[model samples]
Target: MKETAQKYKRQTASRYLPVGAQEITSKIMEAESYGVSTKHDGHFYLLSYDGKKATLTNHGGRVIDDLPLLKEATALLKGKCKTVVLAGELYLHKEGGRTRSFDMTAALDDKSTNIYFAAFDLLSLDGEQVSLDIKALDQKLNTVLSSGKSLHAVKNSFVESRKDIAALYKEIVEDDGQEGIVVRSHNGPTYKIKPLITLDAVILGYAEGQGSRAGMLKEVLVGLCVAKDEYILLTKVGNGYSEEERKNLLKELGKKKVDSGYIEVSGSNVAFTMVAPNQVVEFSCLDVFGENSKGVISKMCLSYKDGTYTANGKQPMASVISPVYVKMRTDKKPDTNDAGLSQITKIISLDINASEKLDVKKSEIVSREVYVKISKGAKMVRKFMVWKTNKEATGEYPAYVYHYTDFSAGRSEMLKKEIKVSDSKKQIEEIFAAEVLENVKKGWEKVKS
Candidate 1:
């Protein structure tokens, strides 16, 4: 049997680099000139027209026949082209004019919602691949596209300098609903840069891997603790961990095994072996947004009220855009790290003062001043500040002493002692020693047996 015309594959952008101002500038400079387009947070699918009918296939070349969007795309593209393959993003727009990946998943079942295929490239025409220059190909795709509401040619621009690329990226992220930008060169590479939010979440368990990762840890199940012994499973992060990190994590997970428990994830009966929940991992993703779909929203442990959504009344838990595990935070404790769902939501929403430069400077200053002392028989550190009491006293000046149990967890506050000029050296030492012991005890209690 001859293969159907619907079965077509196209090359995609696979080279992913860290999305940052510096990295983007370097990539753009290497190319010397590149085209910048909005990287919509949606699936990449190919809309193919075989002279008569239109077919939609995902980036992986798998046919997607059930989506209402695909059905609509078929009707819209019918007879529009002789034989053409258009590459584009399949996305669903939210109420605030933002497009989300989860919204695309939710819109699959909703026939009323209009799905958009934002075409950016023309892979083939009339059953033959287009071998024209980049600029010519773009122009050809624009001319062939019909006046359809569902399909659109993605807006993009060509720039020669790094400053223009940086400015364009900033404008896209800030003013254009936080959607990322993709910089593509004529005969070079494609790089994507997006506004990413990082957070620390507790690892619950691991899911079994398939293919080459079989018998190894494939995905780590992570969540945020809303209350004592209560948590909401946020996402199953599969990307970002290195091979060494994966092997090390598997060994570590072996040491902290617990009973398998039921966790609710959308459209799956996934069981996880509960761990100590003491291990914290850092993750970075696009952003969090609310979902109005009942089927999609029901899977998440979020509450909706008065046209607003929150996770445990503390953070927004609509859905994390595209979460990727950055690293296993060995220095962080689940209870102490406040980079949970709610905290991340606040930072992303700009409710709390969030600045990359300021945060880095603050962290550097804190690391320099705060000294950590490991407690006896614990994987915990006790931080303390030592200073002089007075000139008359044999010791240092401002007799104020502040001690902390765990710096990353920020559990115990600084035990301060008001210094007086009349206070003796012995009195200051005694006060400091007493506070140190108390902080040490508090730190030990937080460690899981």
Candidate 2:
């Protein structure tokens, strides 16, 4: 189950576009034949049945063996096939409220919460990959799955024209309360169409409100990390929080105030009080744009140091559209891998460098040391090199590279190496000292090259 989860995680997530964007949706609707399925607001999981036993694994590699849904699936498929795997959303239904991801998360620990799985795709059957079309796959699921409360097939509709696609979107998304619709082509690309999109970013600053909301925060400035301690200003979110929440956030951010160097306003003439980048927040927006309507890059990158933010003259990757505050993610941190540009690029296709390509300086080697130590008639060599990556100006590369290599003629592997990157000269120097102290012992002799 862990191996299968890792394999699926490597596959690119399906691309998506705004449902109202006729320019993009029109092209997708032109596919020869397609099927539409409701985009459930739930967690993604895979169900694998091996004729005798069944297992369920979430995208994050957690195995769920105790859900009643798993037991039901195993019994239904006992004599049907040797093995089968299906992919779908794991959601919990509410009696009078709409299905939401947050609600599902809150009920995960409640054994009596009635968890359910909506199988959408037939990935494999009888231990062989299934390459059937959407219609064929739907038929197979109907025949094999039969009906059950805890486990069932996701409902779908087949369409051939733009008119039909638009109608389905209206019915499923706007009227039926589903988050969105996913349309899969018979021979082309698959698309996820939605009215709004969500993003996770780090808080950079805040602005005070006025008039009726004068005592609270009016809006919060947010950015996405492009590198270590470097963030690209994305957007300001003002709506979707209560008055009490606004007041609490203002008091919380006041202690983190810092000096602003590049940005000054929220694009609306309101002055900003900059703060440290420490909080990870989730926000919903209508869309994200790499360029403004005037075809100009509208985002800027900044570097933070010693409680200050300064402009870093590098091309920005993106900016948000009409963002609204949602919730704080205490489990996440403001780092490159968590709050990075790849988070946005993974969901939607954007030409971030459409205006102009950026130029970067080549890396310069600053120091090199090679040492040899002879032990018991065998020779072992160690090498250390340090280089400055002036490419940080491009907002795409780290500031320095510390590379270490070790080779031994007597070992089966013969070679072992490690490469580390950093944005601080002092930190890199300390790393160099530590490496030398650990590897350079009594019999080692420095060699000039």
Candidate 3:
């Protein structure tokens, strides 16, 4: 089949660009309208169909063959159009209503179902390329695919202010667990805005690649070092590495390779090459999982303990799911990672307490008065006040119950009915000695086990 003269032009968005909600709102207020849509994390493609046959092409306009989704799509659009090209993302929708890129890649081998084409733009119509407006393009695409079951137009909204854009983005990303959003200017080029959550983890090992990347490092096993010379295996991150990055990582791993240690390989097709856990690499992940529904310490690490994987006496390692290798950190050391694990443990304890059917938010240790300290240990202690907005009430209230974490001991405590803001030095000391300190120590003893 012959391709259209108007090929797909990939749009790019940079983090340094002025594409935030405020900037977008300002642009819209200046008589410039923009369409905001969820940027689906999937393969970009342009589907073309003539009266006789249908073909799928990538961003470069080259025809893709033997793909089941494409074939099904061809059948869906076989007689629908004389000649038309639809631009969109090809992805696999999970049963739980999530779009996964890994599953989309697996769909290339006919190993996946529920594959979809999220059509966004109408590129061509009746074998002719036309430059219709965004709204017109959307209307045309929707009209054409009104009866189709597999293909659907991408949903978008027109926004005129920062608040509108922000609300839409939050609804799509945070509430829906989606990647992010893409904002297309009415008369200019398109721009993307997505949240990129990154973390610093120590490199534990490397997994061998297969096929075109065989013999090279396919994925790097990374972990969080909770103590000196102590590390917990997190997850193997393979995506986001370029060809040059893979080669450079191979060289670095060769220099850092140690005796094959506690590195575990979950699959037979991949081999693990153990390395010294000294190099710290930064990774980007989708979302962090915590113990409770409130998502406390959810930014620290991703959990893989869905009862499938375990380590260290059946204890699951705090891992980042769908970790994308970003870059190696030369300035940060492995020991600095302890605070994250400590925070995770603290959140876990809080979650445990929350699971006991306690109203954690309303439960506060009110202080009678504020006091200042001047001692050797005072220099090491950081104090801050947190005010939480009471949605049911008219004003914000201070969160008197504070979390004091001992990173060195890997524990935390939530003290109640102690350390009042109105308490004097003697009263504070007496309270600490009489109840607070001992209660905290006892709390740690329970949490540590």
Most accurate candidate by TM-score: 2
Which residue runs of candidate 3 sit more than 4 Å off their true CA positions? 1-7, 10-31, 60-62, 65-72, 75-79, 201-449
Q: Please, what is the TM-score per model?
A: 0.49, 0.52, 0.44
How would you encode candidate 1's per-residue C-alpha lDDT over 249-312 as one tens digit per residue? 7767866655421222211223344466777888887655442222112222333233232333
lDDT of 2 at 127: 86
Pick the lDDT winner: 2
Order the candidates by TM-score, highest first. Answer: 2, 1, 3
Question: Where's the lowest-lDDT run of ten residues in candidate 1?
Answer: 358-367
Locate the minimum summed-lDDT window of 10 residues in model 3: 414-423
Query: Using alpha carbons, what is the TM-score of model 2?
Result: 0.52
| Predicted structure 1: lDDT | 0.56
Off by over 4 Å in 1: 1-11, 16-18, 59-80, 94-96, 203-275, 279-449
Angstrom error of the Cα, residue 319, model 3: value is: 22
The alpha-carbon deviation from the true structure for residue 172 of candidate 2, after best TM-score superposition, in angstroms, is 1.7
lDDT of 3 by residue, 152-180 (tens): 78877987655677788788877887767
Candidate 2 per-residue lDDT, tens place, 1-449, comes to: 65665465446232343444343355664777888888766666789997788888865567877777778888888888899988877887765445665456446767444677888877789989887788888888877788666788877799887678788888877788767788778866677777877888999988877788777988898989988998987778889999899999998987787765443455445447788999999998865544332232446678999989977655546666558788988988999777888776654334445333446456688778899988889999999987897876755456776778899999976776655567788887887778888989998999997
